[model samples]
Target: MKHVTKADGGRQPFDPEKVQRTLRKMGVGAEDAERIAGEIAESVPDGVRTAAVLRMIRARAKAVHPAVSHRTNLRRALGLLRSKPDFEEFVRVLLREHGYQVETGCVLAGRCGEHEVDAVAEKDGTTVFVEVKHHVSHHRVTGLDEGRIARAIIEDLQEGFRSGRCVVAIDGALIVCNTKLSEHAKRYATCRGIGHIGWDYPEERNLRTMIEETQSYPITIVAGVSRSVSTRLAAAGVVTAKQIAYGDATTIAHDADIPLKEVLLIAGRARAILEA
Candidate 1:
């Protein structure tokens, strides 16, 4: 077995099983899967960076199929929203784009106490308290604690209703995360009618689908955009591709300290993705 350096710089023997599983999950056909597996086996060097391996997989997958590749890449970008504040803002932007009015870090006084909700989404006369659980480590799974958090939000909703803090009736509580939820947590949420939107949930309409439908790719997804560029873009209040697409490239270039030509290229790519 060849040793591969992981993202944390730890070295471990490569697992071929992981390649097959990921290929299947990415919706690659068996024939294509075998070909991709062969390519991976040939391309990966001993002590190759895990991030490089992921890039290779995505590149090879894209060569095999564009639609599936986009789906896989969407999942990757969604998982990268690891920072708590960034993830919360992402959810707010997503909901707002879907026509919901959103507010974040809202503090409301319940009859029992004051509750701080990560986000509040309202649409069509319905209001929901959204609790965001963001984990930097993609391997971590959200568990029973999520259900507990949802239940707590529900309690706050109940008390807020009594205190007139909530003029309208609370519709439901939602748990949104950039990671997977444990089976027990999923069961608990379902039993309580609590909504969930993890990185990959509701098989058909997960976070990937949500972003694709809205054409709201994160700034981090832009080709040739580095972490520093993305951070600068975010600091300038431009978090999504849609935001960049609609804004002036010259101003963005000056503000982000990126060359105007490169900014134009990025904007073009963003528009192309949206049109695609």
Candidate 2:
């Protein structure tokens, strides 16, 4: 008949020394096994729980294996293996490396209701909403049209304003589409005070360029109005054209928000004068 220690569901009397010896035989050192046994003893009540003690012993044994322990810790840190979740995790990691407090899974207002924004990064008190789109086929993207996508992005921006978060409040809202934005779409976004970023190649390449560009020209004004509106209003108060150009819109808007369409109309009038 085989003898089993009481601590491990055996018939033999429970002995901490014997447990340590068994642990050493199983590739755990004496010091580690004793330390783990002490922890188990402290965790349990006066009565010995064989199952719990054995579980502790097993756990300690595994912890001594550096590679196994590292892999285990990594798995725990990474959570589950969902595709979007994994991508978001990588994006947050990259953002944090660049000194941003990045929050994943942000909900932004869409044309219908709620849209899941992939990430929202904040730095120096400014927030940036980012949308990430992934595509598997180059041929599919090469042949497809971008008109609908551009329209959707514009509508989303309109909804974002209605939700009380203007593009000015956000440093920028970026749509990282797998395909590049068409020239017409880019102009449309520029006209509406939104920014578009494209990822025609690998995502890494696109992200690198986007980060560099964002760092270089860090400030973008999405005020519903243009520089001309401020210039005209400032001129009434004896402010120079240069001073109005440099002044902030919110300071100039004063009581009411300037409509972007009105700003565009004023810009057209200025362009007509310049042409003449």
Candidate 3:
């Protein structure tokens, strides 16, 4: 069996099923996904980078639908929230989708000093400090240092809670990020009991899984929204594609100061993704 290089520098036997499954995840039909996967597996050179395969898949997606092509590049769509503020808002929305009541830009009391956290999510008598780790480049990864650093902060918060300095009892910590998590980071998180959800970490429940369950994709994933426009939408508190699909285009345009026509086009794209 031939192998293709994975994004994380690992290589595995080329599985057309894996390719088809991913296409289905992105809302491609079963027949189309299988056909595309078969074509790629037959023609792609051995050891081709997964990124190259994605490009070929995307090129094929153009025949399916332009928005489908864009959706296949979900990582890039996610990177649209590359800035800290935008990514933070995105994490907040995602947590809400998971049934957590969220508050952003919170100041939390800690043993060392008061710390400003990106978000605080509380549910069913449990409170978690949520940190948004945004890597601007796809090549960058969330590593052990990230888990270590977050653990340190949470420990301090736990201390504060014990001392009655923090209002809410500190329970645990969670890191939500767009990048891949390193193996060491995953191990450390498991050992330390730090909750983490990245693009492809925690095999059972990662960011992609959460997004698919709720169709809670960020506005950046909307096909026509450029990075600049996405930033504008985020600034206006318009973060998710689900939001655009459910809102009136005129209202969203007026509030974000974007042209209505642009919002309409963007809205149609969002609807296509959510409904596909």
Candidate 4:
């Protein structure tokens, strides 16, 4: 057996071109083989053995296409974002418009301890704690599962309300999820003296109407003045920063003649200002 050695006495073949050809034969593409060969040749120790260099080359080739793997991961992440319950901030804005003093992102007691409540709303003489869930699938969630979650939320709220641990008065309670779960949950909630509001899908008219009725004010004040001021204000009654932040951008774009991207940009800027 002949031993190959580099000029520096490294016990390995120094021909990167040969390594690249070997990689190409092992199913690696020409471009990827070139990249892998360069990395291995440049980084491997001069004194390393030929067997070690070969092993390193093989491992590098396998790990080099990580970006390709990331595409699928990114797609899954975007899907989750699209279906996130808090994406629209629906419950938060609805309560604000309806003249209910609202506190968002508050943790409430649950059967298991502390469960986060999306919004706690208090009106003239009644108060309600709301939990919002977003479900994107076409299949509806049965009341059995959703009802249990709702019941746990309501029970936690009731416990807190009775102890006077929080400032808001609890005259009622509600759980708001996708429209599919609304009917079933409503029946269960109503039986227990808890309220349930269903918003099936995004509808400009329905959202506008809800905002108007809840806020006791016109849409113009809720949604900022923009190029499509009159139409958008009339259609959605979005008059305030809070309402605009919570309203659906897709609906706003369709009715207001403003691009969805533009609406989002404006909303992002507005949110930044509000946070500051």
Q: What shift in Å separates residue 30 of candidate 2 from its native position after superposition?
A: 56
Cα lDDT tens digits, model 1, 17-80, are 6776667555567888777877787778888887787777777767765644333355556556
Roughly what TM-score does model 1 have, to 2 decimal places?
A: 0.72
Off by over 4 Å in 4: 1-88, 109-112, 137-142, 160-169, 200-276
TM for candidate 3 is: 0.91
Model 3 residue 44 lDDT? 92
Worst 10 residues of 1 by lDDT: 67-76
Give me the runs in candidate 2 sitting further than 4 Å from their true place: 1-83, 109-112, 138-172, 200-276
Q: Please, what is the whole-model Cα lDDT of each candidate in the order they appear?
A: 0.74, 0.46, 0.83, 0.53
* Model 1 lDDT at residue 268: 77
Model 3, runs deviating above 4 Å: 5-11, 65-72
Q: Model 3: which residue pairs collide?
A: none
Worst 10 residues of 2 by lDDT: 215-224
Query: What is the lDDT for 58 in model 2?
Result: 58
Against the true structure, whose TM-score is highest? 3
Clashing pairs for model 2 are 4-10
* RMSD over all Cα atoms, model 4: 19.9
Instruction: Arrange candidates by TM-score, descending.
Output: 3, 1, 4, 2
lDDT of 4 by residue, 1-276 (tens): 223454345554478888897665344678999988888778866566665776676566557532121111111111232233332354465666657688876776543466666677777767777766555432345354655776666666567767765444456666654434445565666577766554432244233345334432222232233434534433454444444556787887676677788768655543432332
Q: Least accurate stretch of 10 residues (summed lDDT) in model 4?
A: 69-78
